[model samples]
Target: MEIFMKVFTKKLFAGAALSIAAMSSAPSFAGENPTSPIMGIPASSLEEFGGREGVRAWVESLFYYIMLDNRIAPIFREFGNPERQIFLNTQLETMVLGGPNEYQGASMSAAHADLGITMTQFNAVVEAAYNACERNVIKYHTCNQLINALAPFTADIVTR
Candidate 1:
C-alpha cells in the first residue's frame, strides 16, 4: 500500500499545482462594458431569435435537455422548484434578447453557492446554454455577448 499511497500523493500535488497555475494564468475579470454588442443589442433585433415565442421555445428545449441529460440535471435538481426554474429561464432569455424585463433573480453565485459546484459542472451548464442558443439560430456573436454579460456572476456560483 505504500507504493499506492506515494502515487496518490504525487497525483494530488500535481493536480493542486496545475490548478494554481491555471488560476494565475486566467484573465482578470472586469465588468462587461455597456457599449459591447452584447449589452447593445436592441430588443427589436430579437425577432431573429423568433422573438418572445422563439425565446420561450428555446428555453423549454434547453430545460428539457438539462432535465434529461445526466451530466447537468442533478445540479439543477439540487435547487428544485420547477415553476421558479421556468421563471428564471424566461428571465435569462429576456435579458439576453434585450427585452424590457430585467432579471430579478439572485446573482448566479448566490443562487448556486450552496451546491458545491465544480468547474466541470459549470462548463457543462455553459455548453447546454450555448446549445440552446444555437438551436434557435441566434447569432454566434450574440450568444458570446450574452455569455460575456453573464460571466461576471461566476464569482458567486462557483463554490469550489
Candidate 2:
C-alpha cells in the first residue's frame, strides 16, 4: 500500500505539472470561459449528450470503465452503492447541462482536497467519459466539447 501510494504521488505531481504546462502553453481565448476551437464547428452542448437519461447511462458506463482501470479503480472501490452512484450521475449530468445547479454536493476543490487525485486519474476519468459517450452514440466532437468545457476545473480537482 505504501509503495502504491508513493507511485501514485509521483504520477500525481508529474501529471499535474504537465497538464498545467500544456494549458499554459495553449493559445487561450480572451474570456472567462473559453471553448475549444474545433475547425470552426460550434461548441456542442449538454443536450448533445442525449439529455438527462443519456447522461445517466453514460455515467453508469463511465463507472464501469473506472472500475476496470487499475490506475484509478482503487479510489472508487469503497464508494460503491446503487443509490450513491445514481445520485452522483444525476448531479454530474445536471451540472453539465447548465441547468439549475441542483447539485448541492461538495465543491470540486474541497471534495478532492484530501484525495491526492492526480492528472493521470483525472484524465483517465475523462477518457472513460468519452468512451461512455461513444457507447451512447454521442458524436465524438460533442463529447469533447463537454470535456473542453469542464477542463477549466482541473486546477480545482488536482490536489496532490
- Overall local distance difference test of candidate 1: 0.57
Model 2: per-residue Cα lDDT over 1-160, one tens digit each: 3354345445454344433333333322332234232222243455676656667777888888888899888887754464576676665454544422344455556667777888778877887887788788988877765565455556787776
Runs in model 2 lying further than 4 Å from the true structure: 1-44, 79-86
Q: Which stretches of candidate 1 lie over 4 Å from their true place?
A: 1-45
Identify the candidate with maximal lDDT: 2
Count of clashes, each model = 2, 0
Error of 2 at 84 (Å): 2.0
* lDDT (CA) per prediction: 0.57, 0.60
lDDT per residue as tens, model 1, 37-90? 234355455566675677677677678767876876887777767568777766
In candidate 2, list every pair of residues with a backbone clash. Answer: none
Model 1, position 86: C-alpha lDDT score: 73
